[model samples]
Target: MRRIPLFVLGVAAVAAAAVLIAPGDDEYPANVVLPSATGLIPGSKVLVNGFDAGQVDEVSIKDGRAQVTMRLTNDFAPLHAGASARIVWKAVLGERQLDVRDGPETNPVIPAGGTLDGKASDPVEMDKVLAALDPATRTHLSSLVQGLDHTVVGNETDLRQTLRQAGPAMEALGGVLRAVGSDGPAIRELVGQLNSMVTTLVNRDQQVRAIVSGLSGATEAVVQQRDQLRAALAKLPGTLGTADRMLADVPGTVDKAVPLLEDLRPATDRLPAVARTLRPVLADLRPTVAQLRPTLGALGTLLQFTPGLLDSAHGALPGTESAVTSLTPALSFLRPYTPEVVGWLSNWGSSAANYDSNGHYMRVNIPAGISSFDNNPGVMPPGMVSDPFPAPGAIAGQPWTDAFGSGVR
Candidate 1:
């Protein structure tokens, strides 16, 4: 009896499991027929408008019309009536789903046994995008694809040859990568060397910074002194002005100095001759002075004797008083002669040459002919010479005259 009970329990559990694994029963929503959904796949998420509302259970064809059964969510019963259904792929190669869109609010719910007369989407049926293409474009596309297929089929040998040729290189690359992966010490040693190099550079960083800073300061100083540097530069304006003035004065100074220097040059050139001549003369003059030195010493020594000599001479000078009376007549005779001498001097030379009228130059002397421009008149043209020629606003010695009829104040 217990075996019978156990058998009954086993049969009941099997029946329950069978019901649990079964496909959709007749209790589910009735399948709707969509003539446009022939190529749609099963298990695709069905959308109402843009929202997920159900999944497609099956796709069927009958009497040249497609039928897709949509098992809708509980909240999407509004899609039961008056909704348009279309089929679309999930992704490029993904499953295809049926989507329903609600018409205007007044559109009645789709009847239970009603047919959904709708169009397939672009990818599956391509009714919309296909309509835009010309019939010739379709024929060309078909021919192009056929040509491509033929060409690819024809190049199978070449493709296999190329792939076969690439095999060795790929294997070599793989081997090299595998070798690199196995090189532990080389990689670690390289890393250590890199680290050591970095440390060395870091140790010298302060010196590099100091050099950089010094260079920066030098650059700044140079920038600040730019104008002074430019002034000191050998540019045309400042440089040539100095050159021009120097050159301009060189001729005149050379002219003035050349003759003097030339005259001195001869004296300099004859220095040996003069020295030779003066050598003996100076030799004789030295002895003559030496000989005169005794005489001068004797004269100096005779200071005491000269007073006694002078006393004797004074004693020798007897009375001139008696002669003074005779000298009166001679003195009167000299008075007349003095007046004649004064008149003779008046007719001698120009008043300038007179000692009382001590001006050295008054006129150009014919023998002294044009002594200098200093005393010569009309050396420069009249009005052409002044202390500074062409003073302010003067043009070629013409004084700047005011707009009025008078000279500038």
Candidate 2:
């Protein structure tokens, strides 16, 4: 009796377990037919507007199409016509779900026991993408992959070193990019100018081609002369260093020159007026200068003789001084009688007017003897010693009495 009871208990436990694990036979309100079920199964969740509505009940291939029968609960009932159903991956290469997008909200729900045909849009296969590449591109891609594999195979340490070294450079590059981005308008303007320049170059394409060809030739020539170039490059550092040292003193020189520049400013300011005034003077002088060409030509000869003339003048300068000194005493002795001599000449001028057709002659008479007043001269003309004596030539061999008879009377 206890064995029978144990058997019955075992049967009851089995029945309960079977009822829990069995598939449900609940009737679905609507269904949809799909073109393909490449990644879907019967137990896949059916989604309406991205929410799980129900589960797929059966999946079978009929007439080259996948007839996916969905068992939607009452909440997902009345699946409207014109609704679209597709099996979408929940995650990349992950489990698929049935997505149903209903048509217009006003569209009538699909009738029960009716089929809704849906289009399945599958993800592109990797093979198809690979097959689409051209031969050259494929070759390049293959080479790139092989090179990467080779680089990674045994160069892990080197790769790590390279990445470490690149960190600072990448940081610096980021900083530069950030700085450039901060000046957005300036960068845009630069880009615009570059675009204009490119357009100009494009417009002059033939010229650009010629320039490129010339540059190519020049590059070849430079390559041929690389040894000389290298020698020059070797010397360039020292040259640059010397130049830098020389330039170091320039600021001091410039500071020293500041005062001079400040002083020159006033002069420079007046230069325009000076230049204006000089213009007419220079124009007028042009002809005079032209006329002076001969004179100027002789100037060189004049200059050549000037030394000799100067030497002669220097030699005679002492003699001239001596002669001038000697004349001083004679000039002093004659100084008192100068007035008498002047008076005699004034009185005798009226008396000495006689002339003949044969020749000119002076009319004059000589007194025979000295008068008492001759010791002291008077300013009057008739006084003794006032009149000048007759010239010796006029009195020669002639008696004074006869010559001066009229004057003595």
Query: Which digits, one per residue and each the tens of the lDDT, describe model 1 over residues 39-104?
Result: 476777777665667677777887777777767654655334456677766555535777676666
For model 1, the stretches where C-alpha displacement exceeds 4 angstroms are: 1-30, 36-39, 111-114, 122-409
lDDT per residue as tens, model 2, 271-375 = 999999999999999999999999988998899999999999999999999998999887655554455567678768766665679766777767555453566
As a TM-score, model 2 comes out at 0.32
- TM-scores for all candidates? 0.24, 0.32
Residue 255 of model 2, lDDT score: 97
| Number of the top-ranking candidate, with TM-score as the measure | 2
